[model samples]
Target: MQSQSVPRRWLSLLAVPLFLAACGTPESPPPEDAVVRVVTPYTVRSLDPIKQGLWSPEWGYGELLMRATDDGRVEPWLLESLEPESPTSWQLRLRPNIRFANGNPLTAAGLAAVVDRHLAENARVGESLPGADVQVLDDRTLRLTTARPVANLPHLLADEQGISVFDAAATEPSGDIYTGPFRVRSLSAEELVLERNPNYWGGEVRLDEARIRFVPDPQARVLAVRSGEADIALYPPTEALAQFTNGSGPSVAVAAQPLQHLRAIPNLRKAPMNDLAARQAFALGVDYRQLAEDVLGVPYRAPDGLFPDVVDYALPTQRTDAAEAARVLDAAGWAPGPDGIRQRDGVRLAVTVLTYGSQPDTRTVAVAIQSQLRPLGMEVTIASVDDNYAAMRDPAGWDVGLSFDGTLGYTYDPIGPLRSFLTSGAQRNFGGVADPELDTLVAEMEATPDEAARRPLLERAQQIIAANRYVVIVAQRSSPAIVAETFAGYLPSSVLHHISAQT
Candidate 1:
């Protein structure tokens, strides 16, 4: 579904001040009958699904067994149904007469072979679905057994690991294959071109050819769409939303599903921030609303808690109170020094916040946060790092880190991500949290299969996270795109399949 048209005030993030042409004038016509050209901020890391397809959506050459609808429902696309047969096993039934673009029939044996390939090489995928051994029952039926009883097995299978089912006999397991509406025509550093597959299982694709260009800079992407160099632009700069909404450019749209959140991760293992009181003060100090409305200049719903309300079992919203924040800092024995920064026993309340330059908004948020913490006597230094993850992993490299996290499992499930954050000893538990009670709750949530039973546990975990302030969630991200007026039949969902050609 298309998001509501952004108001004029909110479109300030997309405003381009120096451009003469707005939306009214059509730019140069399509190049020699070009179907559609898409410009995205993401660079093509790899065409192989196992390599980069799990995260990047650039390669849409293959299809998944099931896909999540815009409303986050898991519906069968390639597979008819995947039912649990035993505690550790599931029965998969393929849709009848499904065929790859190359005219290879999708059989149960071929899927089993693909599963084996993942198990042998892609350990991360294998770990995501532990002991995922597939057994073919017939041409249309297969049985899948996991090492452990993964409650969200179907969700786990919704990613690249479970989505693309290649026929082993027709092609090698690792090379590029076509199952979706489009087949890969050519791929280079600058662009990727696709040709419509006549034998695709999902019926005739609308577009004759789909071309995607990798333009990392947000401004360049917007300019491309505005100039008719591209039909659609992905991840436009939040500061340039005005350029799209002023009714002089391509139509701006936001896909709000599978929400991503930007958060502040305090190193719990450190000294000043190690104290719960300091952490609470840190959490309460930042004004998320100001950052959203003022700094971002875009329409953003300031997250009340960690996860947005759309996420299952998400807690109620919370806002910052400056008075309470000061009280909390005072209670923790921090006093305003001569420099107007907080100090206690010779130690200053100075912390460096590390973020990457790739996402321009992160730096803006960091600067805004640095300004917001001044009244609270917190000295925040904004550090724009080249490798954000490496800096986050290093104790000496950063004190507080800014990052956007994706949810666990394949779809919108939070259990996997929660486990990484809350569970003790989890590799991704970067905050150095060691709460036994929270760990127990995460374990319970992971073990429990029924969503009914899992709700309370998830609720309790959210409460614990709120109280501890492990990660200060700033805002939930709604990934936006601006498509040209000529780009018709655009697929509007979380799963962004290739666009169809305009009639």
Candidate 2:
């Protein structure tokens, strides 16, 4: 299940000219009631909820039926209550008085329409909710039906990428189509302007507007905050934390344990990596401690497994031994060549590591991997692409890929990452992992309702992933942000988009 290539126009957003323009402008002093300026590495190329990815919810321009707490517990947000009526059925009651940005009331029919649109537009939705059907019980209540008993239905609905409630009547992408804290005032490749939704159902929004600017370069984001050109700079370089913590300028707020974990995925479908010993060598060759402490800086640590420590079912910390890695390569007949790189059957133990610019730290981590693996007689080539997913779909383009994998924050459970990346024929499985055991475990976990009952299955699934060395878990990152003094008390969340100013 390969992902489609990103539109050329969308990739054009990362052009050198646009990056220069973003860094060229100097922000003017804002009035007492001015828009809050936010500089981040992400950009929203499309206003369509289906194509927006996480930007719609992150910008507060759209809302989901359910939301997750800071600790990753799923709770009703747009819905007043969600209870399982049966194994395959659930009753959803929307919160009363909820309205879109255009002031139109949110009814069960409207919600149904949004669901239907998603099912029609996205194949993943239909695959996720097989034999899906929705019935509008009344103005506020709806009954969701599925062919299979989805134990984590609530978590699925809570996923912003899965289903977002928007005004189906609206013909185009605009603020009116969404029911969130903010409305899309204006959007471009470089910037997005969101105005507060006056008819917000939850409570009064303190800020009048939010101006989000896209700065792909981590250093540029840091400079933007230091120069007072941005109110909040998201994902600033970890090495630059010293400047923010000096107490002379803006302050830095780091998440306790961010759900984002940097992973190095090897192309199991390609040469050298196709061998289990090669994959194991690659994993053991990496210095997880140095990557977490020296390279990633404070708050970041070597991951226990595929997930962060915050996840209850995460496996024990993976082992790292360069000597063992070398021994494994030697035992596998990969002898060191004249240039010190291992070679066997005339094929060098060379790998192309792919990373994207969106999460700037991925490139840094890739470079570190290149350096660490060199001493182990592995030739690591780094290819920093604009779009990693698209590039990764073609295994010939790269051997190993460095990127962030979100567990609780993105999917509210470890099941999502497992099913998406490790299961047979799963989407985003660029590493080409296909294990019957892992697939069976994931299916059982999905069928099992209680979290307590599912813990063992989750643990076993992680063990399988680790044993196979499907992905080299580098380190868990701490969500770092530099904030202006005016927004001094701003704290970054493990959930990337759950942001707010401390007024």
Candidate 3:
């Protein structure tokens, strides 16, 4: 499904959460037939998909459609098939013999109700395309009509957003609601325990019970993998690489996906970016190779353009020219001043860039960026806001910030992110870039059924966004998830952090 536009105000809501340190990381998959241990960096706060971002693991629980990797196809779980009856409308055929974990029969009307409920909840939270973009047709077969034609409907449907269809009554007076592969048995500040859905429609779930033991530190995560204390985990840093040992003690598996858009967030309302030349200077000054190699590590490769893996249009380009940056700075009327920093009309070319230090690497990369910009006589102050990544959408956040985003779908889908920028309330627009040409192309791409016609528009959008340096395309990262041996069935689909299973 296309991304629901996030309001600018929503940007303020994205920030590093204060880590609720679990007493200590728990041991790996329990000996019991059904128990599994999964490790992760951040703790999930909400079971509601609309309140949190759609693809979050909290949304990817006991249910949701898993994407097939071979050709990047969509397969079903709760659904049997979702065939389109019309360009604007489609019929979702639900598997007839299915039941919720609570033994409620899975019905189409119940699914429709969940959709409406999620829309209402998100709309209240300032989402622009909430209920405004969806319509449910009937009880057995819910018909959906979009504001525009979307080729990525299955991708949208496969998301964890409203995928979990709960029985209508369970959703009515609930403190908690669930309909995935696992049912939440209990949860607390320290742990979240889940039991396999006995009535799961997808046959037998691989394991019986799964518990997510929160480990806030990357080093601790690595230790768990080696000690066989955890089955799967995210946020393994370079320091923890030794533990992998080429799939050592507890063998490891890794997965990586590069995002289509990276945030080169310059406050359009602020100076510098407001001065087009200043924005260009910052864009050209960045060195992509160093950041990718030093910060991202050996397995990582820099992106060529905006989208990675896909040829023509990628982010980490084969270019890193300091001369180009200097030329742009000079063209913008920036001359060397007493401080050796560029000054145009008595304004020093210095600004603070905001990013969270949770992962730790972003800050190191930011330092490299600082040294590169310093020679160009620009002063950069990089601050760790922890939860501050979302603040860029707010004009008051910072002069600039780092933005990296990607969606797991058939291919690099630019329509959603592009539309996010054009739509009035989109939370993704930190740089505040708006172009009629881009808007037109994005609209056409969304409505058109032809891939041949759409490719050029997507290409053009990436080119211009990169050319304008809206968000400096630092690197389209190849996603890397270092996992433990005891863990298997980690498909990177099914699960947002990592599709996992107990070996």
By lDDT, who's the top model here? 2
- Candidate 3, residues 1-503: lDDT per residue as tens digits? 23223222211122523222233554354555456566777665544345543423342344553343323335665677776655566667676767666777766666665565556565531232232333344445566665446655565555555343555555222112445566655444556666666766555567667767678877787777667777666656755565556645554444444442344567777776677777777777788777777765644556555565543433443367778878988887999898798888778887887767654555766787898889988899887776654666567747887655553333334566566653334656656777778777776776664557667777777777766666566655444445655455453332343432322
Q: Considering TM-score, where higher is better, how would the candidates rank from best to worst? A: 1, 2, 3
lDDT (Cα, tens digit) per residue for candidate 1, span 1-503: 01112112211212422122232333443354557788876665445544544522224567677776567676676789988776677888989888776788877777776666656567766677775677778888888877877767666667654444554454222223546666665555666666667777766555677767889887899999888888888777787787767665477777656366787888988868887878888787888878777777554557778776666677863678888888998988989999899898999999888889877788988999888888889998888988777787777857888887754333667777887765788877887888999988876765677788888988888888888888888866666777788863353345454343221
Question: In order, what lDDT does every prediction score?
Answer: 0.70, 0.78, 0.58
Off by over 4 Å in 2: 1-35, 45-47, 169-173, 185-191, 214-220, 238-242, 326-348, 356-360, 383-386, 407-409, 498-503
Model 3 spans > 4 angstroms off: 1-34, 44-61, 65-77, 83-87, 124-140, 146-152, 171-179, 250-252, 260-262, 310-318, 389-397, 407-412, 421-425, 478-482, 488-503
Q: Model 1's lDDT to the true fold?
A: 0.70
Ordered list by lDDT, greatest first: 2, 1, 3
| Per-candidate TM-score against the hidden true structure | 0.87, 0.84, 0.78
